[model samples]
Target: MPPKQNPDAPAAPDASDALDAPPTTKTPPEVIEFWQETKQTPEELAFYAPEYLCLTILAVILFFPLGLVAAYFSYKTMQDNKQSSWEAAYVNSGRTGWLNVFAILIGLGIIYYALLFS
Candidate 1:
């Protein structure tokens, strides 16, 4: 025989009820600021397109010099704008461009040594 349920008492809490509850604490100010800074408008995103394109194609096709030039312009734009959302894009583009340059140089060195020894 089953035990009788209490009619007047509150029901026991379910584990799934915890998951349905909204967060109690508010978002921190720095996190909100970071989100605002990184989120770009369409125009701002378009502004980065050419820099990104140059970084992608020029790095591979032109032996990394033109890519570095593109990176420089991107960084300069970020600096000139001062606290714009595009700053992150420019910083990433510059870093990727420089890394590509180093990779190309290292690859060339490896190929040269292989050819010389062979």
Candidate 2:
């Protein structure tokens, strides 16, 4: 016969149940704010900013895979800019995109000069 189980003892948690459980950490206030901001209504998001688009296009033309990644972030910035709280993302993306472009330009210049002098 199988051993009798103790009814008073707590049952072991099932692996599947563990997988379904939500994360223990509470969402930070800043993250909640950012999420709420990004969910702004369409009317609020109507204004279109061309900076991200321009940077995305420039990056795609000058760079390749890395440019594509920058373009994705730029696109995200555009979407996030609908609400004032999410403006930081737009600024960050724009700054990164521009920096990437400048870095590539500088690198090309250095390579050109190195080849010329050599």
- Backbone clash pairs in model 1 (N, Cα, C under 3 Å; residues 3+ apart or in different chains), count: 0
The count of residue-pair clashes in candidate 2 stands at: 0
Q: Which ten residues in a row have the lowest lDDT in candidate 1?
A: 49-58
* Cand. 2 Cα-lDDT: 0.62
Per-residue CA lDDT of candidate 1, range 1-118, in tens? Answer: 9999889999888856543343334858775564466554334445662244444454555455644554565556555344454656566556665655664665567679889999
Cα lDDT computed for each candidate against the true fold: 0.55, 0.62
Q: What local lDDT does model 1 show for residue 13?
A: 87
Q: CA shift at 88, candidate 1, in angstroms?
A: 0.9
The digit string of per-residue lDDT tens for model 2 on 43-76 reads 4455434445665666666656666777777766
Please give the RMSD to the true structure for each candidate, in Å: 12.3, 12.9
